[model samples]
Target: MVGLYAALELAPEDEIRLLNIPLKRQTEDIACELQVVKLRDNPKYIALSYTWGSPTSLNNEEGAEDISSKPSRLILCKAKSNSPAEPQPLWYRIMVTENLYTFLLKARDDESHALDFYWIDTICINQKDSEERTRQVNMMAAIYQSADIVHAWLGEEDKDTGMTFQLIRALASCCTGNERHKRIEGLKDITPKALGTRELTAKLGACADISNWKSMAMLFHRRYFTRAWTIQEITLAKKMLALCGSHTIDWEDIVKVSEFLTVTSWTRWISEVTGSHQANHAVPNILDANKTSGNILYSLIRSRRFMSGDPRDKVYALLGVAGDSVRGKSRLTPVYGKRSVAETYTLAAIQILEDSDDLLLLSCAEGDSFHTLPSLPSWVPDWSCSRALGLGVTGYRRYSAAATIPRTLEINESDRCLTVKGFRLDDIVSVGENKQDILSGKPFPNWLLIINAMPPIYYTGQSRFEVFWRTLITDTAGTPPCHPAPHSYRPAYVSWITSKLSACVNETAQQTGDSTFINALGALAATEIPGSPLSSNRPLSSHDNERPGDSKNSIDLDEYETTFSHARHLRLFLTSRRYLGVGSESLLEHDSIWIIPGSRVPLILREVNPSAFRVVGGAYVHGFMKGEALESNPLFRDITII
Candidate 1:
């Protein structure tokens, strides 16, 4: 660390450094040689894809290098001495995290992996030199894509790893091999709803093992899947295989299983088994990620951070995979020290809006109005926080709130406000419980309270009670996940709600592996609210006698819960005009909903002053979703949101 080393300066713009592993090394000697390679020469090497774990804090008793992990071991790096005139090769002792050290040891002993040279970010990149870091980051995509093999280290295996890996192989096989599954897979929208009641139950059973659902859930519990950098690292890799201790699994199999779980909504059951909301959440993120083809918006949505302590990385980390982020094309150039996080986030929001040519990014700002960075404008999203967009905003569902009119959207970076032209749709008068209530079957009462306050008739004179079920699912249903609601959902909704009101959640959840429904509906039977409609006096619907084990009833609960779970952490709201909708958990009583032009769904905006405002988040209002509020000669105001 002293005069023994200078810097790992990658002198040439096109040249890079690699850690050279000697074929035979002294067991006691930890020194590894360094090799410089030119991209033109096309050398063979493997890169590492992993998450930088929690750092050791100042209060940590370990007293070790605290950047990525707690325990770090000394590694000798071959470097040049400080003297320029007579540069001598010196063995410099450096520290690598215990995790990385273990990975290196595994790589060394791995007879299957024969590449001698390796490219690891922490050792290969000059982190202390900001200029060099920027240069290297620009080449990260090319580095991963050009690598002969990219080995993803999923950290040392745990007790569940064996069972999870076995389940992963089985589920991955079922997705591709099972003939019964293949019939449903052949349909354009391969969802559980696409199958008949018998097929749905049979399909759930036909998988190699549904009993190992907990193990499958534990696989996603790995921190490696949540890091922002993992998206680009695994996405751009030419050939990738995940390594966990002694076991190695193809990355494609993991992707296939995750995507399969997503379409079928089987991932929701993981929450019941693992009792971890994180595992419940992670599988769908894999659904959002496409291996080789994805756009900037999709890349941004999938890049959830693992708190690397740098907010700017939430945007910078995904630049490599953002199709629009090519050098000259993207306004989002990855700058290190030049800009603040506020400036970076503002710049990124502007860049994405202009590049994406829509207001979709505005919908992604899901945190509470309390801006993490005080300087960050309300219109500018704090990418540091991870949040999912509204269900209506997903590619699977289509809703055009503004007709075919060209957008009059403008970004006023000088004042940090977005000027958009559209009419105010409604004001959120009452807000209900969010997705968290579903696990306890308690969301029903407060949501029912909000819906009950409104008139029985909808704006179009349709039954508000009927529309309530449609609004719960954003009015999209069918055999496919994204189809229009068939007449069946109405009766199905009756059966779904009555089943919850009549039955006991603890007993039913154990029988059906459905704690979420019990959580949502259990409150009605369990709690006695004074004016709650479904209190003791109200008779259970016609389906009360049908047990959850009944095939017909089980299929309906599966379909409804599966559909509702996809849109997580949303709160039901009643607008001032009696319109019902589900919005971001951040939605409040006084927040106004606006139908901004060129936006697929309406957005919640909190007024800061008279005309200026702050974007709350996206919403799925019942009546105005399909441009019903847009009149031919409707006046559009230029509202500015800071």
Candidate 2:
């Protein structure tokens, strides 16, 4: 055993102990030793980030014991008396994981790497002490940041582990300076087919190789990426090194490769080329680490896939990286064992909303009709529920008039209820079942059938009626048609639905040999005379002659096929006033549509009581979209929801 020196003194309150790596391996009963020190002493050390391998597997290994069942005990170290006049040696006992012990022993024995002290959670913190564990977990961000270097241990290396690190290093080296910038830009513009081309393949080096891509993808599949604490551990480190058995790689190289692989269209290309056999689940999170900053709410929501033994730690573990303003507003003090997981999550939601002063968090809410956890309020998203659906609408214009609404949200902490001041736009008179498509397995059925199912609206003539279905299906459902310059600047909903459809149909007809579909579209356009009373009042042009099968024009069958395929997921619902809506397949009868204050799209709400409702999810109601509801004469009221 190493002798304890009495030259240094530590404060009684500073109970953190650092594991000291012996100079050489020992044949004694205790293979390693620990040195008790104060964190206030500013000791230089390395922090470890790793996943606790399954206890069953670990316990079965030689020299491994089930420490989880053992009670924690304190070791007392008596310093050797100076000149034989002082007392004997001090003794202390600390509990640590078998894997950590193995890592420390290896680091100590390796001549190339000399390690003195380490801050590992399992050994440093007294896990049996709830208060101490809470305090230590809360300080993880600082501990990792304060370390000289953070080491990520990805278990013992396998046959392909060295290949994974080598591949990442090669990729990082290739993507640098002026050449790298051009490659990234060129990759952005490259089509899916071009990914496998000789020119592109040579530029990306081994990364373009299907075998290397599979190995790299499998590397990320390691369990270290799925642990909740590892997010902050890697993010807060000033410098980090990833260790896989004997192989090592810089953390920045791993991050760079991850970012490169996550480019918008590249994921699909890689997944397809690789046959989707490799695990790419953790790639998104590695990318998110570089993008998300200081927004703890965003981090928490994004990290829902991460696993934690204690549910409360999901929120508590993230407090270290949360911004100062968010922390102040949330005022979450770590008190393990004092509150239930439900209470902790509910508190986090309330505090986040109060701090952000926006309802963007509500966008993460799960549909009440789908999966509901017992005892959880509908408004408070259950972070533990991994199956929550994503926000229905995208491309939210942040500066839009509807987004600027001044609404105050209040939380009833005791009852776990939410209150907000907003108007009731319309009551849901009827809701259609989720339409299913046989081809794509999506909920969106035929757009024409959806619109016709609604009550008849006033029209100038039968020709005008035919035009409505054609425009709404081909334009609103498929892709909005394109129009002349001045008309293109109209309200987003109107301009979007109108211009894209016309352009898609024209382009689709001019590129494909599907004369049957083109003739049907042309006949519908011809039925409506030039001077008909259309919503936009724009006359149908003479371009009907350019339909598919026209000798002079070429039709794009790809776009034509894509339009029908994409439109299959949308289902239409009608309110009592005949207001039309397009939303998810989960929509049920009597579900109300509401344009909540800060949300980008109107949400579907299910009535729980006379006036109280639970959030079903967000939706795209045709006329009510694009802030139109805010200008309408609806009775605004303060409503309480759970």
TM-score of each: 0.82, 0.69
Deviating ranges (above 4 Å) for candidate 1: 1-8, 54-71, 79-88, 177-211, 279-288, 291-294, 305-307, 324-326, 329-331, 367-370, 395-397, 477-480, 486-492, 499-554
Among these predictions, the greatest TM-score belongs to 1
**Scored by Cα lDDT, where does model 2 land?**
0.54
Best by lDDT: 1
RMSD per prediction, one decimal? 7.1, 9.6
lDDT of 2 by residue, 478-499 (tens): 1122211111111222322333
In candidate 2 the C-alpha lDDT for residue 476 amounts to 31
lDDT (C-alpha) at residue 314 in model 2: 70
Candidate 1's error at 420, in angstroms? 1.9
Per-residue alpha-carbon lDDT of candidate 1 for residues 329-370, written as tens digits (9 for 90 to 100) = 445777888888888888888877777667887777774633
Can you tell me which runs of candidate 2 are displaced by over 4 Å?
1-15, 28-30, 54-102, 174-183, 186-197, 204-207, 269-292, 326-331, 369-372, 387-389, 392-401, 425-587, 620-625
